[model samples]
Target chain A: MSQVANRHDALDVVGAQWQAVSPRLVTLRRLSLSIVLVPAIVVLVIVLAVTQMWWPGLVAAALLVLWLLACVLIGRQVRAIRYARRDDDLVIRKGVLARRLVVIPYGRMQTVDVSVGPLERRFGLASLQFQTASASTNATLPGLVATEAQSVREELVRLGEKRMRRL
Target chain B: MTGLEPSISDEAASPLQWHRVHPATPLVRMWVALVALALFTLREVDELVSGGYREILALAVSWTAWAVLVGVIAAILTGFYISWRCTGYAVDDERIHFKQGVVWRTERTAPLDKIETIDVRRPLAARLIGLSQLRIEVAGGKDSYLELGFLRLADANVLRDELLTVARLHDRRPGAVTTPEAGIAAEHSSIPVEDALYEPSAVAAQHVLTIPNSRLFAAALLSGEFVTSVGVVIGGVIAVVITGSFATLAGVAALLWGFGGGAVKRFTRNFGFVVTKSDQGLRIGRGLFDHTMQSVPTERIHAIEVRQTVLHRLCQWWQIRATIAGYGEEGDETMLVPVATSDEVLNFLAHFGARWTDEQTIALLVQGMAGDRHQAGDAFQAVPQRARLWDPLGWVRQGHWADDDQVWLRHGRLQRAVSVIELAHCQSASVVQGPLDRKRSLASVEFGLVSGPVSKALDHLDESVAVDLAERSVAEDRRFRQAATAVAGKSGQVL
Candidate 1:
């Protein structure tokens, strides 16, 4: 009974960690989209200016600012999100507008890669990419401290390895 | 199968002896330096020749001498770098470890149980240099669990033998035992070898089958008729002035030579093909001067495809390829035979335990002709319900599903061809609609199979039907995976 209770408690922790970490991935998604958008918007504004269209230039600038503001807001919202790991699964719950809860069982994890990008490095953060057997289905737990990401990756790898052994 | 009794002491002892690999040979450094010097010389040659011709010639000789001196110095530096960076590999009873890299160092360690194959490749140059490249392919990632690129051939062979011995020992261990006869291996290995073995060969053979040399020459000649006509007009004028009219003959010779050169290039580049059995599974090595060796372990193959073209049918040739689990070269798809005869293709597929039916051949023809304008009479002769909305020119056909296979045709004012593809082992499916396709109410459904280099697309179907088919294919893929896993479990080979 104690063992079962301990397992349940561990599972609860895993679930909480997964929930805490997932929404933070939106920061990466927003950053990636913005990287593409900013250059495109700049090019569009330049093109409009070259065409001697003052109205289109102003409209493009305004749109760029709005996009920047939206990006900032999304980044903040991502920082606020978090996830936790349960004994058997990882739980990811987030979203300011549309709430979502995702549970990924430990057995499903094929690989856990910890990566740090330039921006993430500035923030002293790392992202853990959880890849499953299915190519299309994967989850990223972003915006954790580097140490936290390492610990989480190691823990997940351990659990995943154990599950693999059981199979 | 012989079950040789393992000696008790052999199990207890370590199977490997570590010997440090030699540094990268002097020849490698010389080769690099020679290329660099040649480029530098080419850049400076004209400038030197223009000013101080004699002095520059002396400078050029001195430069060669300087390059040799620098090469020697660089070789020593590189030897030290390589020796410091390179490490020996050894496999103990349990695991294998390889430590080597220059600046961004990496030490890979994989359990002996995880090892798939230990391959040693000896290129002509490497053989002459007395070195071999050892690549240890594991069950995981892009990185060779261990790669020693410049090891003495003897050392590499010993290391390969040791790793293989350890892997075999690990496999035979009571808890870790995995044998191909365990049922799951049959299905896992068979599907991919079967699917990929035909399609790529068929696609490749099309180049040879369609447009024979005479036809190509005729086509070229026809296309260049304007130029020839202009030449003839010039020759008519020149004939009146010239003693023997040699100019016209010269012009004809040049054109023939140009056509002959093009034909020779096409033939030579696509020469020499052989698909043979290797110790692991199958080896497909082809090309005239530059040979490519592709090895596909029967188990790692996810899918196989056999494709035939209209031209290939006349020649009775087909192409075979595989969609494998791991990525190769540019990306995932690896061709077993770019081109081969039907019998050779069948022999290759037979190695993987798959056979094609007579009905499948007819099915292929039907699939190819379904949306083609050239085969319109045949298309209308036995029109399946799936072809109801198929526009040979501007008809919008959408939302038709035919069992496991789907056909789509894009018929416009000029364009025509049928895309008939299978969707059983599909991994992802999508329906794409461009502005033109949307205006015509036509869409293309792409099926991503588990094994192969290319996704099969059924184009010019009705939008709704395409979407429905995409959804159904994805669902079917999921179902197949489930069935495969269940089948895998019953077979009891370790996943």
Candidate 2:
């Protein structure tokens, strides 16, 4: 918790608080990347076998291992991300290597969904999905504990409702 | 009017309970399912004759399982009839209540003031049966309204008239004088309720266009499966001629026959499309065997598209479709019309309060920007450097000021497209980013419109520019809406 606070303080120093997302979500991120890579590895092996190229198979395996390592490193970095609410907007700052900052105004929020998948369910963790009217633009803050996710969703909804009523 | 009792208060009596009055014959929707089952059985029998005894035995066991399906369908039909008889709706001075469902009965109640629009639809089969379906749309979620299917035609009309009268009376300003009962009595005595409610004057002039049967047939022919089947049939014919393989030829012939049958079924189901102008909105009713009636309000329309295929252009015909709010089972509910002339389109636009300037400059800009060619003209504006780089489709070219107030965007392929976004309707604008978009430093800016349910989006712009433009647009819209609302209030109109 102290480390998390220090990380947030560091993010604030850079004036990029909105780029923060939950650090614990790194587990889910790693799992998703692994799932994606399994099919790619299978396809690569099949292609190499079909071509009867031993060196190509070795190269493909090497690339897969490198990709997996990169993903794990990025996942660990993402796990350190955190977000905070500031006045009428929520700020998310994320990414270890290529950081991103997103500021979503409460009035623009259409729906706030708190979803817990099978793995997240075991860890009592959930993902907060923020939907806006524009289908193309959506923000997700994944890997918060279930209770925290619910609280965030409720806060966002209340803010959104207030904004709608003002309009 | 004199004999009618005063409006009943909700405190005095229970709200009317609505029932689901489905067709007495549930066989209509079930017939296809049954037919499919029977065909499956026949296929199994054919397989058994061809040395697939195990498949035949498995199919026979499944035939018993299908009995439950038949029973369930029959029960549903019976339940529908029973519920229809039992269901009723009542609107008191304050609340409207409806009761429905079969085994698990449900009741819904909402305030009368919450009602936005009441639609009454009569499909071909329902019309023949002298029945109509009534749906009430309200402000909440998609299913906020009550739907009562298969009401007697006369009863439906009476209900519609009564509801309309109540709505009008409730909406009347406080100081406005109520019309004398004598006038009401006179009007009611002379004009039938159906005629009064469904008068031609109540129908808007802009008729929705439906896609023609011939076009649908062309589309079917162009479908992947259709093309593949044709190829297979041609290949089989050539094979038979070259090698005299009777077995292969026979199999191909069967496949061809099945494909033809499927095409015929498709053609038959989509026959006799009609676009009817109704008081609620534009009702696009189509489908031969399985009827579909979709109503799109004029206010909810986002964009209207008029397209002409090469064949349609040669025939001097065009198809018009509108992007509307709300999701339907079939994705976008498109209304198809057989033919629409250019003159007719102008007239339709005028009726819908859309400006149709015949200025050659406007036309030239539309042609030059919407088309692939970059024709140099004094009237034409240059495409923004940011926009040109972002839009790979290159469909969206120059967006320029139109009539000093509106911004016009010209985009589309072959048919050519033009859109005029009024500053008044523009709400919040934003720049969107995806992984790919971030890499390109390009974003999509969406403009939220005030149109009910349906909103239009303008995509692809520089992120910073999009945010600035959106903020400005939203501010302008707010000011415009405020002024418009003030004027409406002064006029004693409920906007």
By DockQ, the best candidate is 2
What's model 1's TM-score? 0.48
Query: For candidate 2, lDDT tens digit of each residue in B1-495?
Result: 010122333543553443344454233324466678768867766966576677667756796647866786677667656756556565656455666555766666655434445556666656566667666554344456666555776676556555654444442322211212222333334454334435443344345455568766765564445766788888998888898767787788788888866666555555656565555455555666545555544433444545554444454455455543232112324333434565555444443433444455335434532344355553533344555555656434433333423444445444444454544323234445555545655444455432332223445444554444444444453343344445446556543
Candidate 1 Cα errors over 4 Å, as ranges:
A1-130, A133-167, B1-16, B20-31, B34-87, B93-95, B101-106, B110-120, B129-131, B137-146, B150-272, B286-293, B307-318, B329-333, B354-452, B456-495
Docking class of 1: incorrect
Worst 10 residues of 2 chain B by lDDT: B174-183
Candidate 1 chain B, poorest ten consecutive residues by summed lDDT: B202-211
Docking class of 2: incorrect
Candidate number of the best lDDT: 2
Instruction: Evaluate every candidate with DockQ and list the scores.
Output: 0.05, 0.06
Cα lDDT tens digits, model 1, B1-495, are: 001111233424555555566665434424566678668866776666776679676876787857976887687677666755456555555566555556655555666666655556555556667776766655544543456556777766555555554554454333333332322444444333223223222111111122233433333233334345556657656774776655566665576466555544334333444455543455444433333334444544544445544444454444545555334333312555544555555445556533223544444434332333334333322222344444443343212224543333222222222333444333344455554555555556555433235335555665556655655543443343344446657656334
Candidate 2 local accuracy as lDDT? Answer: 0.53
